[model samples]
Target: MATYEEVKDIPNQLDKYLVDVRNKSELKETGTLPASINIPLPDLEKALNLPDEEFKASYGRVKPSTEAVVIFSCKAGGRAARAANLAKTMGFANAKAYPGSWTEWAQKEGK
Candidate 1:
């Protein structure tokens, strides 16, 4: 699991990808974390499987290699945990879940 401090420090870390697994509606209702990419949990598998070019076109970012460190976060961390497990099954060796997630972030950041 990842901590809020680690998530906050992500912008300075080039090897980490902070992924928000919340759906679009939720994100619109309650903004996402800084420097995080939205990849709704439902679409995560397909998104990860997309070709490099297609992935970039769809997500506006490079596809994460299997060796890349991916940190998944969601509303209350449930979906993030699931997403991390899913990524691990798909061969992402360093996949992790942010247990405190957005709720903690918002509370801590006064958002």
Candidate 2:
């Protein structure tokens, strides 16, 4: 699992992928974590499976390798955890969930 602090600094980490599992509507309503990409839970598996070039064309970001550090976040964490587990099952050993997610992030950051 990932804590709010860890998620906050993900941008500085450079290689880490902070994936927000919330739907695009939710992100428009509540905003999203700094530097996190929107990859809704329902589409996450297929997104992760996309080839590198295709993934980049679709999401405008490179596809994370199986060993990459991929962290997931959602409204209150449920979907984030589910996404992380799914990534792990698909061979992403470093997948993790940000339990505090958007709720805690908004509270702490006063967004």
Candidate 3:
């Protein structure tokens, strides 16, 4: 799993989707890190398969290539790591799981 220190310096590029896999209620209870897109782990495959225009229409932006940086996060490291592994199995070469997930982010952001 990627550490907060590792992912913190990653570029906030438009094509990269910082995914928050925690459910909607969790999202509502605690706001996500800046730039993250809420596509719970269960929906990840479908979301990634969308065509450029459709994706932009649905997700509000286009995603990078399967080989590009795609960051995943959850309440802690476990879920995000599993999500990242799933991404890789789905052909996303650069998918990374943030070990310092919501808890770490919340602590750092003072949420």
- Model 3 lDDT per residue over 1-111, tens place: 666765555545555668888888889998877777788888878888888887778766676588778889999878889889988998999898998899998788677
In angstroms, the error of model 3 at 85 is 0.8
Give me the displacement of residue 55 in model 2, in angstroms: 0.6
Instruction: Give each model a TM-score.
Output: 0.97, 0.97, 0.87
Candidate 2 TM-score, true structure as reference = 0.97
Give candidate 1 misplaced runs (Cα > 4 Å): none
Runs off by more than 4 Å, candidate 3? 9-11
Per-residue accuracy of model 2 over 1-111 as CA lDDT, tens digit each: 999889989989879999999989998899878888898999998999888998999887788889889999999999999999999999999999999999999999988
- Cα miss at 1, model 3 (Å)? 3.5
Instruction: At residue 27, give the lDDT of candidate 3.
Output: 92
Tens digits of per-residue lDDT for model 1, 1-111 = 899999999998877899999999999999989889999999999999999999989987889999998999999999999999999999999999999999999999999
| Cα lDDT over the full model 1 | 0.95
Candidate 2 worst ten-residue window by lDDT: 58-67
Collision pairs in model 1: none
TM-score of 1: 0.97
